[model samples]
Target: MTRAVAVELRGVSCEYRTRTGRVLAVEKLSMQASDREFVALLGPSGCGKSTLLKMVAGLVPATAGEVLVYGRPVVRPLESLGMVFQSPVLLRWRTVINNVLFPAEATGRRDAAMRERAMALLRLVGLTGFEDKYPHELSGGMAQRVSLARALLLEPTLLLMDEPFGALDALTREEMGIELLRIWQEQPKTILFVTHSISESVLLADRVIVMTPRPGRVAAEITIDLPRPRSGRMRVLPRFGELVSVLQDEMGIAT
Candidate 1:
């Protein structure tokens, strides 16, 4: 039996009309993310990576083409999808668990099961002990983990992440990447991650969808065959370097 397509973009195009002129951000982009697969949108600045993400999240409408989730047209945000931004965006006053509970409350899911699910998600993100800590008390990486936990609380079938760890320090970013993989392994959800880092894409994604510069289109989609449970050591592997080099060339960046 064939698996279902979790998300599909068909000839999807977006154009913005400005005072100067119409600016095309993405054009004729077609892609599908399989159920439970972790896919990454890898590209340079102005590549419209975030634009595609916004379209999926229903935050912005596509100028042309269709965006579908679970075989249905997505004209607006759906409950089955959750989103995490580059910033944690947690309320400064809310504790970690409260922040996780915020979404449930907003969606009117504040029930016993919802509370249990929120606490479970916090533990899944490895923040079991820091549930009561405020965002100010948490480090950048820790804060992002809370954000991830919050997104998971919605029990979304699809998770959309836009450069979710772009602001962390090098070491912290690397550690968070590992933690993300662990979360993915435990509870498989279809993930669409947008990232500027080639290595991060290769490390975390089952497939890397490389987009072109402005007016972004699908330049290439490469499958990452590296073994799972990937870590820093995978960075030094020969095949890993080759994949990075290929992605670099695709991005028109020097090796």
Candidate 2:
């Protein structure tokens, strides 16, 4: 069965105008994500992975080409989209459940039913018992869980995540990766994840898009045929090692 296209970028280029000069970030990059597909973009530090994600989410405009979501041009910030950044930007004063309801409240969607939905979302992200706890009371990973629940409050179809687990410790990052996969399974969406960790990308994504540094463009595309409900042991398997090795080579990194 052919999956429908959920996102499309055509000859997209992003340039920043600064006092010094024009800096080109993404140059003529094109890619597509199928409906409910989990796509991960990987590259070095200076690559435009994050910029590309913002463009697709309508937070940034491409200096050239176009970005389309569900076949429509992304001309402005998409209300149907949800975004989670590196930092879990939760309000310190708000309790866990309140923070999760922030997005819905922001757009005036709050109601008895919406509040119940928010609680359910918090539960989905494994924050069921701590809904009333303040941000200061939560751990780093717990805060991020709140952020994830807040992002999903609107039940968006396109989810854009920019290194959501980049700040956590190695063990926590791995745990979050597994939890994210579980949430994705329960509630499907078209996800575009930006990350630098080769292992994390391989572990979560159906297809990993590798890019070159600055003036970022797709350098290689690796399809992971690994089985679903992935186990932690899968990362040590020979096939997983092979895929990671291929991605490392694409980045010119010695394994």
Candidate 3:
């Protein structure tokens, strides 16, 4: 069965007007994110991946083009969209559970139902025992997990993640990736993840959308045909190497 398209960018371009001149971040970029699909935007630092993400989140306005979420034009931040940034950005004073409940409280969703939902999300992210822990008391990875739980508290149909695991050590990053996949499996959401790690993109995305530098555009899109529930072991598979090589070539890296 064909899944519905959850989000789409039609002729999307982002231009910034500065004293110097107009700086183009993205140009005529178009893509579709299917329902329940995990898509990764992979490219170099100046590729406007984060710009595109901000646009999708309605935090930034598009210069020219249209952004649609679930067939509706996305003019501003919608309640059904959740975002996780590179930093955990948790409130230092709030406990883990309180931080998780921030979204609901901010959106006037603070009811019995919302509180129940927040607690459930904390449990989902393995923070059940750490509900009262402060952000400084937790490890880096644990803090990020709290961020993840907070993002999911809204049960948004669309989730935007900007290199959420980039700050962790390699081993911790790998573990978090696995944990993310597990969470995704349980509560499937259309995810647009931005990352510089080619391997991380290949591991998590159903479709890897590569972008060019500066005035970013779609450079290439390599779909991962590897089986679902991907583990670290899958990285050693021949097909995995093939996909990695292909992405590297697209990124102008010699295989």
| Pairs of colliding residues, candidate 3 | none
Give per-residue CA lDDT, model 3, range 1-255, as digits (tens): 899999899999999888999899999999999999999999999789999999999999999999998898888998798899898999999999899999888878888988888888887877788989899999999999999999999889999999999999999999999989999999999999999999999999999999999899999999999999899999999999999999999999976
What's the distance in Å from true for residue 133, model 3?
1.2
Clashing residue pairs, backbone N/CA/C < 3 A, model 2: none
Clashes of each: 0, 0, 0
Q: Which candidate tops TM-score?
A: 2
Cα displacement (Å) at residue 168, model 3: 1.0
lDDT by residue (100-185, candidate 1, tens digit) is 99998997879898888988988888888898899999999999999999988878889999999999998989888898899888
Listed in order, each prediction's TM-score against the native is 0.96, 0.98, 0.97
Return whichever of 1 and 2 wins on TM-score.
Answer: 2
Off by over 4 Å in 3: 18-20
Q: Score residue 67 of candidate 3 by CA lDDT.
A: 93
Cα lDDT of all candidates, in order?
0.93, 0.93, 0.93
* Model 2 vs truth, CA RMSD: 0.9
